[model samples]
Target: STTAMAGSGLFRLPAALNPMDWLAQPDKPGISPEPSYQRPQGGIEARAFGNVVHLLVESMANAIARGEEPDVTQWHPRAHALLRAEGIAPGDLPHQTQQVVRALENMLMDPEGRWLLAPHTAAASESALEDETGRHVRTDRTFFASDAPLASGEGTLWIVDFKSSENSGSDVAAFLAAQKKLYAPKMLEYAQTKRAQLGAETPIILALYFPLLPALVYWQAE
Candidate 1:
């Protein structure tokens, strides 16, 4: 007696296909058996740290897109609040604030990071899109880069997803390569979706940006 609508909320996309989950790995062993106990009053856990960085970068990118300078001083309170919301202890506010501020500084100072956050035509942060299957996808950032060799009238469309993964291993090159491999599937989906929407004539550059490492790994989305 009921007809199913394609875009109905009930038929939402699988979370596993989300870019956020592409690089997700099993939790590493922590200092404490209880997860909450592992994050001390003066410390931040990996997920919380990643959240802080992502939020900060999103805010900064949005600002740049609007032709406004991102103010670092204004972000401290916001970062503190986000950390608290993510379960950081009240006593850890100062330490957490410094950690986030340092990350913001590092991103702003790095040429590659800055370029990723730079303004471009039709720039947007956390841009949500939908696919033909009625699945919703949220891209970390999207914009049109006019500097690219013209493949179409609008130049190149860029889809950038940010990752906060840090490497503790000795082989930095291997670490980056591994990350790209892990996320390639989801990134390809993003590129395919855009290509379907924008047509094959447009050039699309799909990239993974690791701000913490101050590195960028990118490839053409063909």
Candidate 2:
């Protein structure tokens, strides 16, 4: 069955996206230096099932990074079985990601009211954030790692990292916290530049999306 749904059998969807682009920061978008978050929001395509899309993208990227074409038409099934073996077969990936996106879209900058921060892409895993020396520092390394607007309509933005996993042998909260800690410095560094460019306030938000258990954890930066 080509992307057929029979109570969900883990078939690869027709869209096999390469996630490598996300791993390495692409050229920042063209922002007119406004009083906003720095990471420039909303340019990537965001569908309802964003995490699924991210999964597809990461799978493709991993393959292509090794110089192989990602054939989603016949790879997801094998991946699914691996998840099952890990004792984490979650049918919630799609909907959970959708809900997170909706919530984020509704999130507004505090005190004042503004809603333009858009979450265009999903990272699918924090494993994507590589250091300058190329050290993959993220520990959660779960599923659906992404960045969204920090609810501040204005420069220097914060990234929202979503952790999606079945929790077979993992602690969701701990994983979430660790990712935040690792990214805090990076977020600040990004804010420094963004604020300078747009005279925007530095990022004042941090978030985590747990798609498997349908949980969202966030903090407002001071």
Candidate 3:
């Protein structure tokens, strides 16, 4: 197995043999239809916004796993500390902090979102996984179940990648269509990596959670 061969230290795979390399080729056709609207790549402010959201979500998930209610009020101070630690300027901290809170609140209000954030027997935030060959992928969040079927009744693993885009005032279906095209390959790589690590029989489900837009976009492996 690839994971078995990938012992220690970093090893590079040839571009031709890498699935992610193939997906990154500009000429490659996408599996999903094009989106009606194009999402702009995030700027520094946007990246900082996403970082803050991630920190807040991780803190909340950790609290939930410990059987405690997450205190939303604590997020601001935490965000400030994290930003400073990351060398991010405090100029837009107030605006971005509020955005993070709003997004978290929006996610908790939705049924699917609530379930996604709920405590699990085993859960990881910003988890890193690497194959034996040194190919690595970092997942935003992962949930593990022993016996029961996860969402979509496909497998025991549930993986989520969060998007902080404000893709509003547009058709949700159209936005999702574009998102699938943009995210499918990476998500597929994540699933494939997990499958390789866990074994072939373990089913996996990958979902894109857009907290700002408050949408959950799911894709099943073919």
Q: Every model's Cα RMSD, please?
A: 13.7, 17.2, 12.9
Per-residue C-alpha lDDT of model 2 across residues 146-201, encoded as one tens digit per residue = 12222312222234443333345566666556656765665554334323432443
Model 3 agreement with the true structure over 1-222: per-residue lDDT tens digits: 000111122222222343333223332232222211122357766776677677678777777777897887776677777656655667866676677788888776766676777765356666666654566456787775322222332124677888887766567777776787898888888888776755554455567888877777764443
> If both were scored by lDDT, which would come out higher, candidate 1 or candidate 2?
1
Cα lDDT of candidate 1 equals: 0.65
Better of 1 and 3 by lDDT: 1
Candidate 2, run of 10 with poorest lDDT: 1-10
TM-score of each: 0.71, 0.31, 0.71
**Weakest lDDT window of 10 consecutive positions for candidate 1:** 1-10
Give a tens-digit lDDT track for model 1, residues 97-130: 7777777887788766787788655666666566
Per-prediction tally of clashes: 0, 17, 4
- Candidate 3 regions with alpha-carbon error over 4 angstroms: 1-41, 84-91, 145-155
